[model samples]
Target chain A: MSSPARRGRPGYDQDAVLQIAVEAFNLHGYEATSMGLLAEKLGVSKSAIYHHVASKEALLELALEQALGGLEALLTEPAALEGPADSRLEHVLRGTIGVLVDKLPYVTLLLRLRGNTEMEREALRRRRDFDREVSSLVEAAQSAGSLRSDVDARIAERLLFGTINSIVEWYRPEGPLSAEELADQVIAMVFNGLHAQS
Target chain B: MSSPARRGRPGYDQDAVLQIAVEAFNLHGYEATSMGLLAEKLGVSKSAIYHHVASKEALLELALEQALGGLEALLTEPAALEGPADSRLEHVLRGTIGVLVDKLPYVTLLLRLRGNTEMEREALRRRRDFDREVSSLVEAAQSAGSLRSDVDARIAERLLFGTINSIVEWYRPEGPLSAEELADQVIAMVFNGLHAQS
Candidate 1:
């Protein structure tokens, strides 16, 4: 969980306020949503929101940080750091779906942004950086002879991440499938393919 | 090629104009772009754009038709219609990637819309219908014993498409990798899985 902003009131929390803000941005385009509108939706004074977040853009930055930060941190985790290249790659792939499911709203918003602003641009750059790191892992697995070397590592990584990110397009927390089940299916399909191997 | 509007003046094709419009809608959020802006970018009057498309919304529908229509048509193609379920599924998957590459801009816009308007909602519905059709194909392949039945058919379809749809996120027409090469890699990974088969 993110650290709360400077506490301004007895009852309200910054994380809760950010959740509402992220929802409004998700429902309404970030460019179309306003701080005033978020305050209205939160039923708090505009001053109260300002007390938590410095500005509307700040909220966007924090939301993006929340989503991308998780993935970045996953790269250094013990699971990722200590495994064979193939196992580590699997760990990151599963971790990615976990992050997507955990921070669905934030990542959805991040994916939707057009990079028209500095915050969105920074997010795009960081996203590319993350993709590059994952691509290197794919290359490593190929070198280790566990993964097929016929496909380009970069393309393989893109498809793998693409499959993972596409979850945001249709997954609903209220839906019948749990996140764990969905991730398992994804791992099986991506790592093992859909065909029944003899 | 789309039929050009009754030419008010000379020299522009409706297909060409639609391509420009799709690019604009993609670069700028669809809602944020307008007929006047499209005209200004096209170096023609708003009336000229109207000469081709009935309205802003009309162009959106046509562009959508171009993207989704390709996939809808693929369902009935000879390859999709006359093969083992596994082969038919492969044909459809490859064809889906082809359409995505061929109509990248239009599909990108369709994917990014937030369903804030009637047009977007209709597009979303059509998109869901397309997904259902593909899911049925997956089930058929599973029933045929070629594809793994352990994973839920719907989950399998989502990951399959998730990988294909993700091309819109990073594919560039001028990039070093040809669309055919990328599709080939996708097909291999998706059909055979990434792990080296014994």
Candidate 2:
């Protein structure tokens, strides 16, 4: 349903509205960010904002999907699926860093969700599922004798992704480190460690 | 100045109040948790809260100090300061995990701070300074040839601590994993990595 008012703003589509709404949600807690505040941030009337999304929760769902989708897709990728368990784990790890760098704000919002709402709870559930998938992958690597078996696979998965997820706390695209370099360092540190190999 | 009402509440001392307040801030967020809500949560009058601390920001400073103080202490510990650079780094990393586990709620509040207030900014400044100190340790280890020189020291520090800081997300003191075990796994992963050593 195209309206003259909607057409007047050429760039402010559902995507733009979602982006700004996500930024506001990330800045202010999702519960605290009202649609009125989002509309104010988007420089649009409340009704105009509604024309794009059904509600603020809808915007959150869309934003979370942008992040979760990337991660879920990584699990299904040929690189993630085809290789030896350890190398496949590496592919997923690198891919996760790419998703985080590419869709930083969305992933930040996803990570920060406290499951206050059902939508948030569902997003968190999906996140947990993703974690289980990675954990299983780690287990496979351990079984294959590529990953060290002494440490619990679940703990190893948590630490590996913990370091990756923390990138959202500080990584900036315009900053000195590229996403590729970041992935390289993470892979190196988690696989080979900081200790010099003799 | 203890009033009859204050004397009536024997258990609600300043430390107790600060602990609950930190939990509230971590749950509801610092900006959103007003004195009224905190008072309601504490089952005390607003004035009772004031008797413990002058203002909300004062409570925040106390909570942040609880977290930052622990981390800052690690930098100066005899083990942290007196050992081989890499061993010292290991000591600090293990000690940081100890602090995070011991002060989980306070550290969660500290890590979640967005610097909306001057006190938060000050905390962030202190956090950055702590990061710098650790980064310098990483550099020292690299220089000593104990740690790999390939990754930048600053990046190494962030990943090391990032993995450490992430413990607050899933770690429960009541969980099966003891703090010592968590620290051991972290040390093993960061220093020796997850790959099977030949």
Candidate 3:
């Protein structure tokens, strides 16, 4: 309700602006969203936004980095590194759902980008790298005789991520199920499926 | 490779133009890909393209209907109506993969739409209706004691579709895996999971 003229610039920092920017981009799309439109959405002057980020691409970079950094960090986590392959795979899968739900907006934006720009290409490359890393875990689990060997490791990887990534399309923040509950249900379906085992 | 001036109007009917339009929309995005660009993609003049479809929204309606119609038909199939919930669900799941691969471009464009237009809103409504119908099967399976009761039917529906829908994001028609094989692998992983049963 406060006047924009009197609004403190510090109130809208880079992270805060990036959140709004990502939401706008998600709603209006990245190509259609202009700096002027972003300013209007933020209820702040363009100069105020420019104070923190140099350009829209810079905001994109920061937003994508939040998602990429979280995923990359999962690779080095103790559960991913030191455990048996099946356990490690499960760990990473759970961690991924955690990241997807926690950083829903950033990951949603990242998934929607199609390598149109240098920044987008970089995001795609990093996403591919993440997939490869997960594939290695799937392969390892297969080799350990814990995961089914009938399916190719790469195919397994795709299905796993496919199942996980689809959440961005349908998950609502205020939906009846919590993210943890979602993760558990996904884990159950991915591990055991809907068929009631005898 | 042919000149637009020499191309006859009959060469590109509504279906052919829709195929090309969906590919263009998938590649360039629906918002950025103009009718002029569609004419360029189709090797036809703008007027020739307009002769087949009144507008881009009309083309979108046709493309989306292709996917929605296929999904809607899954409800009435003998497998969907006459069998146990597990069998019925499996039938629909396999049929869905078939439809997805068969109509990849149209479904891709449909999934990418953000409900910005009345046409897209209709598509969204139809999509929700499809989800509800599928969820009913999940609920029925749960009631039949063939599916786990611990997981909410709504959650199961999201995960099932989530796993199914992710294929559009990563599936490659020319890749080593055929659509049938992809469906099989997805089914195996979805129903049996990655864990090796002792």
lDDT scores for all predictions?
0.85, 0.89, 0.86
Which residue pairs overlap in candidate 2's backbone? none
Q: Go through the candidates in order and give the C-alpha RMSD of each one to the true structure.
A: 4.6, 3.8, 2.3
Residue pairs in candidate 1 whose N, alpha carbon or C atoms collide under 3 angstroms: none
When only the first chain is scored, the TM-scores of the models are 0.92, 0.94, 0.94
Name the DockQ score for candidate 2.
0.79
Distance (Å) between predicted and true CA of B91, model 1? 0.3
Model 2: what TM-score? 0.91
RMSD of 1: 4.6
Q: What C-alpha lDDT, on a 0 to 100 scale, does residue A96 get in candidate 2?
A: 96
Judged by DockQ, which candidate is best? 1
Note the residue pairs that clash in candidate 3.
none
TM-score of each: 0.90, 0.91, 0.92
Tens digit of per-residue lDDT, candidate 1, span B35-151: 888887777778888889898888888898898888889988999998899998888888888898888888888777677788779888988898898899899999989999989
Clashes of each: 0, 0, 0
Determine the backbone clash count of candidate 3.
Answer: 0
Residue A149, model 3: Cα distance from true site in angstroms: 1.4
Reference-based TM-score, model 3: 0.92
Badly placed stretches (over 4 Å) of model 1 are A1-10, B1-9, B116-120
Query: Candidate 1 or 3, higher lDDT?
Result: 3
Docking class of 3: medium
